[model samples]
Target: MVYYAYFQGKAPDVTKKRFKTVWDIPKEELLAPGHRMCQGCGAAIVFRHLLKAVGKDVVIVQATGCVEVTTTVFPETAWRVPYIHVAFENAASVASGIAAAIKALKRKGVLPPDKKVKVVATAGDGGTFDIGMQALSGMLERGDDVMYVVYDNEAYMNTGIQRSSATPWGAWTTTTPVGKRWRGEWRWKKDIVGIALAHRVPYIATANPAYPLDLIEKFRRAFETEGPSLVHVLSPCPPGWRIPPDKTIEVAKLATLTGMWVNLEIVEGQPRVTVKVPKRKPVKVYLKMQGRFRHLRDEDIAFIQKVVDAEVERINKWVGEEAIGPVVEE
Candidate 1:
């Protein structure tokens, strides 16, 4: 039997070079020229593509994470669009407020009657998976018309290179500092999508920077919807992950290929989303590519691979050809 969740009523069209350049987006640069991100920050790349998809007619409520500090300076900022720097744990609530305010502002003619805008809360995995999970869950339950994009680099990147709930098992971080006694972080990556599924939101999807156009479409569709939307984007962080700058996208691709992360999307109330099966490589191949996991031994790799296989099997169960063609949950 095939399992189908969100992405309902239609299939996600992945075709054409919709974004030729960064300027192709009419929203303008909401997250600007920059103050202090690393040479190959996957979050930055994801941000650029996201802005291109959603456009600048939006208000960004950023958490006190890497994206927030790196782009926004107190007096002067890089944001060309209206943006807010909320606390570490309240970006979702803040963005929800902004959405409500926009509605009221338009109703009272405070801004404009025909104000076409969206509230997007962008944060790292540290914010989304760990500290900010409560706020994120609250916003989803509230079902605010907003987009919560988690640029998950698997660590608390901004403050320092620390492990996060989203960090996969067997990865290294400051908190999970690897040594002879320690074999890296020993916990599994929390099932963020499963958590979102628990909320039963209208739309939730896992994305990758390797497939820019697919990610863009998810954002665009999420924008058009009426409730909360979650896009779990696996963006690569070079400095923290100890990978080269240009290798961000490639590393991101390998993540899925190793069955560590699979690409899928869930629409309103669906049982599962469209899943793209990977080539299924050894997790060690991915681990070895990054310096963070350099200390990992063959036994460690085997153990990690077992976890990854389980994850892939779970996702595969959610993806199959059902009697109902591409069914939507709602």
Candidate 2:
């Protein structure tokens, strides 16, 4: 009987969570208790940890997506920190503006300049990989002092499981469900990290809620950076991904084990990848665990593997590291 899985009562064991000590982290609350989110919602997890990293002197700009709606209902607000909800595609630019304004205010000594403020934008994969992409690219190219985090559950979860450019190839979404005659989602996930790297931001990293401490550390680092930074987070949408609520972190860990999400980073002072992905588990295990890929046949599975292989190979070449993910053998 662990005291980890309930709002106030008993429930099944959730994905294994590590306990924190008082000396390790503060008891500050940012997301607050009244916000509405699903059980095992990865976005909420990321949001909480992200706030913990940046602390209270931060302005959070969010898009009109799940996070924004859940936190800011018309008559109520759940955010303990200053927050602004922008249009679906404007979160990045709005964060950039907020950062610029904060910097100007601090320089003019309008507000207490000693209290360093961080500007963070939280957006889903759809807003990031689709609509907000251009604005994000522009922000990074201009080297704005903002941190943008994408809580990627791999689809448009806020809009009822529609496929997004971040959705994995074999995963099933409402629009890309595998029928009897069809294979699965036709296109591959857009390589947003590669695109971000091409822009050459000061820092770019991939994080997972399964690894909360790691995610928090990256956020702290990104928050302290002066130029534009991105932390691509892999969140688990249990209902959207057809996994059980208890398996949110499990699913996230499986993503890393399957090479579906690589935990790597480009540091501010370096041009090479400072982190490396470990030997990964089979993709089939990760795929079959989700009902979305229930209809994938063996050959179709092989095709997905090929796509992942090519993508990993390209990343390895870019990083000058030897290939570490799965490859098709003769």
- The segments of candidate 1 whose C-alpha lies over 4 angstroms from its true place after superposition are 1-30, 271-275, 321-330
Off by over 4 Å in 2: 1-23, 269-278, 322-330
Task: Report model 1's TM-score to 2 decimal places.
Answer: 0.86
Q: How many residue pairs clash in each candidate?
A: 12, 0
Taken over the whole model, the C-alpha lDDT of each candidate is 0.76, 0.78
Score candidate 1 by lDDT. Answer: 0.76
Lowest lDDT block of 10, candidate 2: 3-12
Q: Model 1: per-residue lDDT, tens digit, 210-250?
A: 87766777777666667688889998999989999999988
